[model samples]
Target: MKNIYELVTMFHDVHPFVPSLSQFAECVVAYIGVFVIKSVFKHLVCLECLESLYSYLTDIRNYSLIARKSNDGLLFPAKDVI
Candidate 1:
């Protein structure tokens, strides 16, 4: 009943289309809490580890031209997303 760009923004309705969406949100929040708590509990862990993970898919992100030129090794197409 919705267009391709239209989205169900509510937490409850997502399950009709993808059954695990609600649970997936819960898991993400839980992981974010752990990431925050671990940063506070320890010495903020390794900043580089988080930074590198921020670009964890550096070579895999499609928006990067460098990814397109250099990422034939990655599984997804680097350019021509459409």
Candidate 2:
């Protein structure tokens, strides 16, 4: 969570946006809720649970990169048709 806070701080600092710690906490809590709920049902082992989270984060990073690169501002290109 400290890492997340630092990353959020750095992102807002670089982008010159207002930083809302409450909103950040809310988002983190929501993700934690989802993780807990999924884990409860899935019975994932520790390593598998971390891998699932890592994969989801990686997908989010990739999506952001794709959105940043696209002129039309769509997350997925029209040609990709996802």
Highest lDDT against the true fold, candidate: 2
| Residue pairs in collision within model 2 | none
Q: What is the lDDT of candidate 1?
A: 0.40
Question: In every candidate, how many clashes are there?
Answer: 0, 0
Candidate No. with top TM-score: 2
- Report the C-alpha displacement of residue 61, candidate 1, in angstroms: 31
Off by over 4 Å in 2: 1-21, 43-82
Q: Candidate 2 has what TM-score?
A: 0.26
| TM-score of each candidate structure, all chains considered together | 0.25, 0.26
- Model 2 worst lDDT window (10 residues): 73-82
lDDT of each residue in 13-59, candidate 1, tens digit only: 55567444454464344334334544543664677544433223344
Once model 2 is optimally superposed onto the true structure by TM-score, how far is the C-alpha of residue 56 displaced, in angstroms?
20
Over the full model, what C-alpha lDDT does candidate 2 score relative to the true structure?
A: 0.43
